[model samples]
Target chain A: MTGLPMVVSAANLPARVRIHEVGARDGLQNEKTTVPTEVKAEFVRRLADAGLTTIEATSFVHPKWVPQLADAEQLFPLIADLRGVHLPVLVPNERGLDRALSLSATRVAVFASATESFAKANLNRTVDEALAMFEPVLARAKAEGVHVRGYLSMCFGDPWEGEVPVPQVVRVCKALLDMGCDELSLGDTIGVATPGHVTALLTALEEAGIPAAAVGVHFHDTYGQALANTYAALEHGVTTIDASAGGLGGCPYAKSATGNLATEDLVWMLQGLGIDTGVDLGRLVATSAWMAGQLGRPSPSRTVRALSHKEQ
Target chain B: MTGLPMVVSAANLPARVRIHEVGARDGLQNEKTTVPTEVKAEFVRRLADAGLTTIEATSFVHPKWVPQLADAEQLFPLIADLRGVHLPVLVPNERGLDRALSLSATRVAVFASATESFAKANLNRTVDEALAMFEPVLARAKAEGVHVRGYLSMCFGDPWEGEVPVPQVVRVCKALLDMGCDELSLGDTIGVATPGHVTALLTALEEAGIPAAAVGVHFHDTYGQALANTYAALEHGVTTIDASAGGLGGCPYAKSATGNLATEDLVWMLQGLGIDTGVDLGRLVATSAWMAGQLGRPSPSRTVRALSHKEQ
Candidate 1:
């Protein structure tokens, strides 16, 4: 990885980007229907086979909270043996972390909301309370030699609270990073982020002593600004991006949170920009197409739709 | 416009942009079901009412070629008196130009291909032959004191040729500019362009002595790169953008040309960036929704889908 040339100038962006695939967890958690455990395992394997190195497998939250991912224990062991891939599961608290550890999970993620409304609605706690809840989870994961990721949701806007201030997001992000998480993923959970807002937040993070290297952007395509915001983030020297296969996932909280930035769409732009993502776009599109068939709907990704139509 | 502060830096982009709304012509041109002439005029009026200053009204191509726009002659006079809006019509040749002149059309557009295969398939002529055919039409329009726009199609890639060379596109764009066309719209007809390709082409255009002001970008959303490509164009200081209402239009020649860049999508990004496009985004979204109902399908625009669903 160090041997490859790095082009960080405005004219030339980073030569490579780390695509953090979140299809199995973030993508399916909001889904209304419960996907069978066998299909969930197969989805993770296909994503890895398409050259995706990091795939978030599932959440270990209680079934009462997220019924769609109730079979995480059954799902994890199915794809845990995939070679050269990092499969991370979401663990909200110590109990979830305990569940992850029982499965011998190598990596785990904990999520916190930046806005009070989202924290209260989504996590049933205040912002501070949510962070306090993750404190022990992070400590246990660190003590167990497990890599941990922290997700800051509603970093751009909130459904109840309009536009989230950049400083507010930075403060929450700094708290998460200081809590010993390996990296932080800033999520525009409501999908209202614009390029300027993304730029402002990334700049604020830099000023708040959170380096771009420790940050990844998770944008929803509700307003079709995901790719544009990603472009802005890349120009700011961010090399990690979170995307879902087949553009899966919608926020049950905000019906307008249509889908995450599709991995195929991200791969298309990266491949065109001469950035190395190591993922095979054709196979990725095929995988999304197959998933769409399973889900009984066309993928919401323009690249997937276009490529599939071309094949026909 | 002068009262607005102009931002012209790499980090801070242009303060204003010109949105060349093309729903009336380019948007409805490829629809399988013919839109009524009265509805077409009303669509143009609604777009203008939404604060768009320039709208392409209709095309005067032969009825057999573009039957959807066959009512161009009748559609022109109905909206000719629209206040503060520049209504341009597409004219294919001397005959079409004559029709445009009879209606006192102030602005006209002629299209040429950057690839030979598209030229032969769409225009039934070689690239040079198509340019020659437009020569007399451009001369007549210029002699009559009419504003003209030259469209260079397949500027990014050709279905048959694949990955068009920048030099080849530059030469064709140079020819169009040299022919007294007031402005040139470089089209990613197949939606195959990435930001890097956009930047490279714009830089090459600059090196070829064509100012960014004379170039407008017309991107299709087949790969969902339209907004990102537009962002790249703005970074290069190109401000004029061509979009269609409700993300109308698909390419008949290229099966992958799913939709044009929706004006609402572009407006959403520009408004968020604090770029002054003088467009009412709510009104634009409503117009697109109305048009979608008329077209008997949901809009393909993510912005429109998000906003409309939010209202529900």
Candidate 2:
């Protein structure tokens, strides 16, 4: 009863770790069939009611690139006035940013990649070109008093390029921070990282003079190391994380990609460690069950499946 | 690169962590339908072929208590005499020990509980009474030159009593060691332990004059913290671990007892961090898939499932 060893920092534990629910945008984007706009909007409301302070409501990408998110215009305005929830939408380019801005989005996210091959495969541009492309959107958002989150995909490893270099990940992080983005999320696009790799990357970022508090980790569970990696990130002073409910979403291009880390599993681990995440476990389970019904299958989340079985 | 930061004890790194496979006995004990004796024997052969050095082949409990293992007499002799492999059986009382000795079992296990209520409910005896029951059996087994391992169930928490105290767990450990048991396994029986609890218990054991190397941890994945708990145990110098392949086994009496820590998942974590376990991942996956088919469902091992999907 020595009141938990004082080896780690306590000041960094945020009042609440803001969960940016990506189930609607990043989650639905990889679905084979297009989800109806109304169904997407209702899911957004259900997530908000489950104590989520922020949710990525939709992605305003071109229909050619992502037909699943084609109804972003219809879904964005439906829950725009929801109380106490910040709705952020993904803006792939200038056109996408304009659509989000037209709906009066308070927060928007822009994407880039750490490697040239992944950038070309995912965004139709080289690494430098993709980073340069987000400059205008970031500038426009900053001028209009809107917050922007910069996403650096394939931070640790890439599908085509194999092991991504540490300097490449740091260079993208610095560029995004310099472009007036408020937060930068380092994504493990293929989820090959172990806890050791996560600690090394975060330690490298700190040594490179990047603010640890402004960084978030997004992981896929392809290797079953996503939650363990998240724990390592917490040890390194990361406060915000990106996870999808029911472990939804898979890459359309990569053949072996799996869903992101499930929100229920992350919350379970965090709450058990007595870290505050402001999530209701019961509601989280119910919402995941409802979403799984919409997807016509059970969730890949171990926590959701285990708790649901208990209720039955 | 400061070289991985040496998170856990890697001095034991590259030293093969003996994964005492318990799938044959602990797994099938709670299964609903009785698998044929030949199926059980075949499972042991495939597991041995997968480079498992120690496998708990079966138990000698009466058919009325565990009907699933009633065919142990037939399955045991058939799977014996494999070179470099040790087949152990669980012996509850003198009758059970006599049964195992008749089958020429070289290794035997006795069960005790850390808490009085769990001991009474699970073994129909008090804590001291349960230990007393094993004294004569140990004497008889020693007379025959057989090794014995003692299982301390509910070392972390229990169904009847919540939050098992560390002192109680340590007392049980000392008793088992004093009784001439060669090894001791600490179980979370209900999967209610976090990493903090694991660190505290193992630290207490070291302070109480017990050699850390004599301990093994058996965890259930009910709360999704079993692997983390195992990591904490390894950090304290315990090497041998009890795991069921494909995350098999659950307690029939405990309400929420789910799967054990999956062997494939454990091997993946150990090998990724450069710990040797002498296991072939491909062959272990094949064995798990084979047993899963017999059980009429998929293996619960996430690593096997994820890797099989990649291979396909």
Candidate 3:
């Protein structure tokens, strides 16, 4: 069904999208209770079985900070042998990278904040200080042949700082790419982004000599703009979309904010548009339902709720 | 702010959009418990005070069928003197139209189904039979100098008949226009529509010689596609949108479907896009929060949830 004309008017959108599944790492990391290592491994396996090419397995952050993902070492090795999938772990610094190297991990990611307030609050460093901290991490990852993804949080709006300027985000994005990160994921940590903000940011990135292919968008649905923001990104030819299964990982900073856009919801729109994501949506929905059961609560995803109810 | 360039790339979108608030009539009618007439009147007053120019006040359906809206007669006169607002009521047939006329309602709406299954299930008539029934109601409404808005439900998909053809929707839309409805509201009753389906339906409507100005789009967030579908409609120059404050009115037929798109969510996007909606978003969010309190549940709207949290 790929490349079929669903709507000739939306012809500007790419024919295919690369979904970067962040459920296990970004999604579970925010859970109040620690997900068992076995369950985490199974979730990653289920996502891969659903045809996801990239599954962020876990974070190597110290257990003191993100205790939910303390079992990264145990979880990563269990899914290491999964064929034809990329299992990337989040590494906060050289120490985290050292742990990843111990496991012989082939891919890892580092996060920085676009706004100074978010950097100070989230990373305990200023914006420039956070970039400086990631410098050596990306350099060592490149030397060790590990793929590096740079995450810039608060790319659109900041709670303390209000509206973030486009130029500031562009400068930080350039710094990450200059340090040898293969891709950049623009994070709307507060979910305050709109389609216009998305277009302006992407346009600025393109003007700064970064190709759209090197950019991915990670949006929370706090203000119900994630899918619309994703649509705007796709219009600019950005194919890498970061979504969590079952809409997991609500922002700890924004208490009432929703989780990442549900992968099933994004896939529904893509499938309807005749854009290929290589995902079996039914299996994905089943995977979310399973996870929702394990969490002892209903999933926050509207698509999950709708489809699961239909099944019953 | 209306004409200000939000994103030069999105300059094609309409500079202003007219929001048709449906929380009072379409929303409350589906609730299990009947709202007090005084509260219903207050809801309408709040919605209008928030700068919503068009508010659907009540439905004149039989009290036996929809006991929730049985106090339409009492609710109408309470807000009948509100200035600078259009209060439209739903009139199912001549009896309902007479009730609306007795209340001195200047604007009224009628509903038809795009699929035969929904027409039979919802109105106890076939698609053609439903249109024939509306013929006289619309003609009488025209002669009374009352504006008529036609609602075409199940335009995208149906529970009994899946994937309704575009031609079927176009034909029904033409019939509604031919019957003298000043405007037609295309409804995704099952919430199964995607952007492509929206584009195809609107394109077919235009091909059938119906201008976009004569159309409004009503969507449910059932599969989480309401906002995205609305975006597609706006891209095609659709100006009027139907939304329910606090995301009221779940689909009785599709038990798990969500209510109409929250007016707060739609306003958040339009405000961020620099489009004029004339709505005080803060006031609108408060209104939804107030209604949610009365409904004894948290609102399903992400915008309402997020903003209300910020206030606290």
Evaluated with lDDT, which candidate comes out highest? Answer: 3
Q: Provide C-alpha RMSD values for all models, in order.
A: 4.2, 4.8, 3.0
Best-fitting candidate, scored by DockQ: 3
lDDT of 3 by residue, A46-74 (tens): 99999999999999999999999989888
By DockQ: ranked, best first: 3, 1, 2
- Once fitted onto the true fold, the runs of candidate 2 whose alpha carbons sit more than 4 angstroms away are A1-16, A31-36, A250-257, B1-16, B250-257
Error of 2 at A256 (Å): 7.2
C-alpha lDDT of residue B187 in model 2: 85
| Poorest stretch of ten by lDDT in candidate 2 chain B | B1-10
lDDT of 1 by residue, B164-282 (tens): 88899999888887778999999988888888888888999999999899999999888888999999999889989999987888532233557899888788788778888989888
DockQ of 3: 0.46
> Over the stretch A157-268, how does candidate 1's per-residue lDDT look in tens digits?
7778777777899889889988898999999887777788888888888988888999999998887889999999999989999999988885323325478998988988
CA lDDT, candidate 2, residue B141 = 86
As for candidate 1, its clashing pairs are none
Using TM-score as the measure, what is the rank order of every candidate, best first?
Answer: 3, 1, 2
Model 3 alpha-carbon miss at residue A18, Å:
0.8
Candidate 3 versus the native: TM-score? 0.96
